[model samples]
Target: MLPARHRMRRSADFATAIRRGRRVARPTLVVHLVLVEGRDDPPLVGFVVSRAVGSAVVRNTVRRRLRHLMRERLAVLPPGSLLVVRALPSASKVSSADLARDLDAALEQATARPRHLQVGRSS
Candidate 1:
Protein backbone atom coordinates (compact mmCIF):
# COMPACT_ATOMS: atom_id res chain seq x y z
CA MET A 1 0.00 0.00 0.00
CA LEU A 2 1.13 3.58 -0.62
CA PRO A 3 1.97 5.66 2.42
CA ALA A 4 -0.76 8.04 3.57
CA ARG A 5 1.23 11.10 2.63
CA HIS A 6 1.71 9.78 -0.89
CA ARG A 7 -1.88 8.87 -1.53
CA MET A 8 -4.23 11.21 -3.39
CA ARG A 9 -7.32 11.01 -1.17
CA ARG A 10 -9.30 14.13 -1.94
CA SER A 11 -11.87 14.32 -4.69
CA ALA A 12 -10.70 17.80 -5.55
CA ASP A 13 -7.17 16.63 -6.10
CA PHE A 14 -8.37 13.89 -8.41
CA ALA A 15 -10.49 16.30 -10.38
CA THR A 16 -7.68 18.80 -10.72
CA ALA A 17 -5.26 16.21 -11.88
CA ILE A 18 -7.67 14.82 -14.44
CA ARG A 19 -8.45 18.27 -15.70
CA ARG A 20 -4.97 19.74 -16.02
CA GLY A 21 -2.67 16.77 -16.30
CA ARG A 22 -1.20 15.13 -19.35
CA ARG A 23 -3.00 11.96 -20.31
CA VAL A 24 -1.52 8.70 -21.47
CA ALA A 25 -3.99 6.23 -22.88
CA ARG A 26 -3.59 2.51 -23.14
CA PRO A 27 -5.92 -0.30 -24.03
CA THR A 28 -6.66 -1.19 -20.42
CA LEU A 29 -5.94 2.03 -18.56
CA VAL A 30 -5.71 5.79 -18.79
CA VAL A 31 -3.04 7.57 -16.79
CA HIS A 32 -3.19 11.25 -15.91
CA LEU A 33 -0.13 12.98 -14.48
CA VAL A 34 0.02 16.48 -13.08
CA LEU A 35 3.36 17.83 -11.95
CA VAL A 36 3.39 20.14 -8.96
CA GLU A 37 6.35 22.41 -9.05
CA GLY A 38 8.69 23.29 -6.16
CA ARG A 39 7.12 21.01 -3.59
CA ASP A 40 9.05 18.75 -1.25
CA ASP A 41 6.43 16.09 -0.81
CA PRO A 42 6.54 12.71 -2.47
CA PRO A 43 4.36 11.93 -5.46
CA LEU A 44 0.66 11.22 -4.83
CA VAL A 45 -1.09 8.37 -6.62
CA GLY A 46 -4.76 7.42 -6.93
CA PHE A 47 -6.77 4.75 -8.72
CA VAL A 48 -10.25 4.87 -10.25
CA VAL A 49 -12.02 1.65 -11.13
CA SER A 50 -15.50 2.58 -12.23
CA ARG A 51 -18.57 0.35 -12.19
CA ALA A 52 -18.23 0.10 -15.95
CA VAL A 53 -15.04 -1.84 -15.35
CA GLY A 54 -16.77 -4.63 -13.44
CA SER A 55 -18.73 -5.75 -10.40
CA ALA A 56 -17.58 -4.87 -6.89
CA VAL A 57 -15.31 -7.89 -6.61
CA VAL A 58 -13.70 -7.23 -9.94
CA ARG A 59 -13.29 -3.53 -9.26
CA ASN A 60 -11.62 -4.20 -5.93
CA THR A 61 -9.35 -6.76 -7.51
CA VAL A 62 -8.35 -4.31 -10.22
CA ARG A 63 -7.78 -1.57 -7.67
CA ARG A 64 -5.60 -3.85 -5.58
CA ARG A 65 -3.53 -4.85 -8.56
CA LEU A 66 -3.08 -1.24 -9.63
CA ARG A 67 -2.09 -0.18 -6.14
CA HIS A 68 0.54 -2.87 -5.98
CA LEU A 69 1.92 -1.95 -9.36
CA MET A 70 2.01 1.75 -8.53
CA ARG A 71 3.85 1.03 -5.30
CA GLU A 72 6.54 -0.72 -7.27
CA ARG A 73 6.78 2.10 -9.81
CA LEU A 74 6.42 5.05 -7.47
CA ALA A 75 10.03 5.98 -7.76
CA VAL A 76 9.59 6.67 -11.44
CA LEU A 77 7.47 9.73 -10.74
CA PRO A 78 8.90 13.11 -9.80
CA PRO A 79 8.33 14.50 -6.33
CA GLY A 80 5.05 16.45 -5.93
CA SER A 81 3.52 14.80 -8.94
CA LEU A 82 -0.05 13.56 -8.84
CA LEU A 83 -0.96 10.47 -10.82
CA VAL A 84 -4.45 9.14 -11.34
CA VAL A 85 -4.94 5.77 -12.98
CA ARG A 86 -8.36 4.95 -14.35
CA ALA A 87 -9.05 1.40 -15.36
CA LEU A 88 -10.86 0.58 -18.60
CA PRO A 89 -13.27 -2.31 -18.73
CA SER A 90 -10.66 -4.34 -20.54
CA ALA A 91 -8.51 -4.07 -17.44
CA SER A 92 -10.79 -6.49 -15.62
CA LYS A 93 -9.92 -9.24 -18.07
CA VAL A 94 -6.20 -8.61 -18.46
CA SER A 95 -3.45 -10.36 -16.52
CA SER A 96 -1.25 -8.54 -14.07
CA ALA A 97 1.73 -8.67 -16.41
CA ASP A 98 -0.25 -7.03 -19.17
CA LEU A 99 -1.47 -4.35 -16.82
CA ALA A 100 2.06 -3.67 -15.65
CA ARG A 101 3.34 -3.34 -19.17
CA ASP A 102 0.63 -0.90 -20.11
CA LEU A 103 1.23 1.12 -16.94
CA ASP A 104 4.98 1.31 -17.55
CA ALA A 105 4.45 2.42 -21.10
CA ALA A 106 1.93 5.02 -20.07
CA LEU A 107 4.23 6.42 -17.41
CA GLU A 108 7.07 6.61 -19.86
CA GLN A 109 4.98 8.52 -22.34
CA ALA A 110 3.38 10.79 -19.78
CA THR A 111 6.70 11.85 -18.29
CA ALA A 112 8.69 12.16 -21.46
CA ARG A 113 7.32 15.42 -22.94
CA PRO A 114 4.09 17.28 -23.48
CA ARG A 115 2.25 15.39 -26.18
CA HIS A 116 0.95 18.52 -27.89
CA LEU A 117 4.38 20.10 -28.04
CA GLN A 118 5.88 16.91 -29.37
CA VAL A 119 3.68 16.96 -32.41
CA GLY A 120 5.14 19.85 -34.44
CA ARG A 121 8.10 21.34 -32.64
CA SER A 122 11.78 20.54 -32.61
CA SER A 123 14.19 21.38 -29.84
Candidate 2:
Protein backbone atom coordinates (compact mmCIF):
# COMPACT_ATOMS: atom_id res chain seq x y z
CA MET A 1 0.00 0.00 0.00
CA LEU A 2 1.19 3.54 -0.71
CA PRO A 3 1.67 5.80 2.27
CA ALA A 4 -0.70 8.69 2.93
CA ARG A 5 1.63 11.48 1.87
CA HIS A 6 2.32 9.88 -1.49
CA ARG A 7 -1.32 9.22 -2.33
CA MET A 8 -3.15 11.77 -4.46
CA ARG A 9 -6.70 12.38 -3.20
CA ARG A 10 -8.14 15.49 -4.73
CA SER A 11 -10.23 15.71 -7.92
CA ALA A 12 -8.52 18.98 -8.91
CA ASP A 13 -5.16 17.33 -8.72
CA PHE A 14 -6.32 14.54 -11.01
CA ALA A 15 -7.71 17.04 -13.48
CA THR A 16 -4.47 18.98 -13.56
CA ALA A 17 -2.36 15.91 -14.06
CA ILE A 18 -4.53 14.46 -16.80
CA ARG A 19 -4.90 17.73 -18.64
CA ARG A 20 -1.47 19.32 -18.21
CA GLY A 21 0.85 16.42 -17.61
CA ARG A 22 2.92 14.50 -20.11
CA ARG A 23 1.25 11.25 -21.18
CA VAL A 24 2.63 7.82 -22.03
CA ALA A 25 0.51 4.85 -22.99
CA ARG A 26 1.15 1.11 -22.94
CA PRO A 27 -1.09 -1.83 -23.72
CA THR A 28 -2.06 -2.26 -20.11
CA LEU A 29 -1.87 1.23 -18.71
CA VAL A 30 -1.40 4.94 -19.36
CA VAL A 31 0.64 7.30 -17.23
CA HIS A 32 0.20 11.04 -16.80
CA LEU A 33 2.95 12.97 -15.07
CA VAL A 34 3.38 16.61 -14.11
CA LEU A 35 6.33 18.02 -12.24
CA VAL A 36 4.98 20.85 -10.16
CA GLU A 37 7.14 23.86 -9.55
CA GLY A 38 7.89 25.04 -6.00
CA ARG A 39 6.11 22.18 -4.28
CA ASP A 40 8.05 21.02 -1.24
CA ASP A 41 5.99 17.88 -0.67
CA PRO A 42 6.72 14.36 -1.87
CA PRO A 43 5.39 13.24 -5.22
CA LEU A 44 1.70 12.30 -5.22
CA VAL A 45 0.26 9.35 -7.14
CA GLY A 46 -3.31 8.41 -8.10
CA PHE A 47 -5.02 5.53 -9.90
CA VAL A 48 -8.02 5.35 -12.20
CA VAL A 49 -9.41 1.85 -12.53
CA SER A 50 -12.74 2.14 -14.21
CA ARG A 51 -15.72 -0.16 -14.86
CA ALA A 52 -14.41 -0.60 -18.35
CA VAL A 53 -11.66 -2.67 -16.86
CA GLY A 54 -13.88 -5.02 -14.82
CA SER A 55 -16.31 -5.45 -11.99
CA ALA A 56 -15.56 -4.37 -8.46
CA VAL A 57 -13.45 -7.40 -7.58
CA VAL A 58 -11.35 -7.31 -10.70
CA ARG A 59 -10.93 -3.55 -10.61
CA ASN A 60 -9.85 -3.69 -6.99
CA THR A 61 -7.34 -6.40 -7.77
CA VAL A 62 -5.82 -4.42 -10.59
CA ARG A 63 -5.75 -1.26 -8.55
CA ARG A 64 -4.01 -3.05 -5.68
CA ARG A 65 -1.40 -4.50 -7.97
CA LEU A 66 -0.73 -1.15 -9.53
CA ARG A 67 -0.48 0.48 -6.16
CA HIS A 68 2.10 -2.04 -5.04
CA LEU A 69 4.07 -1.57 -8.24
CA MET A 70 3.93 2.23 -8.01
CA ARG A 71 5.07 2.22 -4.39
CA GLU A 72 8.34 0.63 -5.46
CA ARG A 73 8.89 3.06 -8.31
CA LEU A 74 7.82 6.24 -6.55
CA ALA A 75 11.37 7.13 -5.61
CA VAL A 76 12.32 7.40 -9.28
CA LEU A 77 10.01 10.37 -9.73
CA PRO A 78 11.17 13.85 -8.84
CA PRO A 79 9.78 15.52 -5.76
CA GLY A 80 6.58 17.59 -6.17
CA SER A 81 5.43 15.43 -9.07
CA LEU A 82 1.80 14.47 -9.77
CA LEU A 83 1.24 11.05 -11.30
CA VAL A 84 -1.95 9.42 -12.52
CA VAL A 85 -2.06 5.80 -13.66
CA ARG A 86 -5.09 4.77 -15.67
CA ALA A 87 -5.81 1.11 -16.24
CA LEU A 88 -7.07 0.05 -19.62
CA PRO A 89 -9.64 -2.71 -20.09
CA SER A 90 -6.91 -5.13 -21.09
CA ALA A 91 -5.24 -4.61 -17.78
CA SER A 92 -7.79 -6.97 -16.25
CA LYS A 93 -6.34 -9.86 -18.24
CA VAL A 94 -2.62 -9.31 -17.69
CA SER A 95 -0.46 -10.76 -14.95
CA SER A 96 1.07 -8.66 -12.22
CA ALA A 97 4.55 -8.95 -13.73
CA ASP A 98 3.27 -7.80 -17.10
CA LEU A 99 1.46 -4.90 -15.51
CA ALA A 100 4.63 -3.90 -13.73
CA ARG A 101 6.59 -4.00 -16.96
CA ASP A 102 3.97 -1.92 -18.75
CA LEU A 103 3.90 0.55 -15.89
CA ASP A 104 7.68 0.83 -15.96
CA ALA A 105 7.77 1.35 -19.68
CA ALA A 106 5.04 3.98 -19.61
CA LEU A 107 6.76 5.84 -16.83
CA GLU A 108 10.08 5.63 -18.63
CA GLN A 109 8.64 7.13 -21.78
CA ALA A 110 6.77 9.83 -19.91
CA THR A 111 9.86 10.90 -18.03
CA ALA A 112 12.35 10.29 -20.81
CA ARG A 113 12.92 13.99 -21.42
CA PRO A 114 12.93 16.09 -18.32
CA ARG A 115 12.52 19.21 -20.39
CA HIS A 116 9.16 17.96 -21.63
CA LEU A 117 7.60 17.26 -18.25
CA GLN A 118 7.54 20.63 -16.54
CA VAL A 119 4.10 21.93 -15.58
CA GLY A 120 2.47 24.47 -17.90
CA ARG A 121 5.32 24.13 -20.35
CA SER A 122 5.20 22.53 -23.77
CA SER A 123 7.99 20.45 -25.17
Best by TM-score: 2
Model 2, runs deviating above 4 Å: 114-123
> Per-residue alpha-carbon lDDT of model 1 for 28-91, expressed as tens digits?
9999988766555788899999999999999999999999999999989887677899999999
Model 2 agreement with the true structure over 1-123: per-residue lDDT tens digits: 999999999898898889888888899999999888766679889999999999999999999999999999988888878899999999999888899999999888877753234444222
TM-score result, candidate 1: 0.90
Total clashes, candidate 2?
0
Candidate 2, position 95, lDDT? 88
What is candidate 1's CA lDDT for residue 80? Answer: 69
For candidate 1, the clash count comes to: 0
**Model 1: ten consecutive residues of lowest lDDT:** 114-123
The number of the candidate with the highest lDDT is 2
User: Residue 2 of model 2: what lDDT?
Assistant: 95
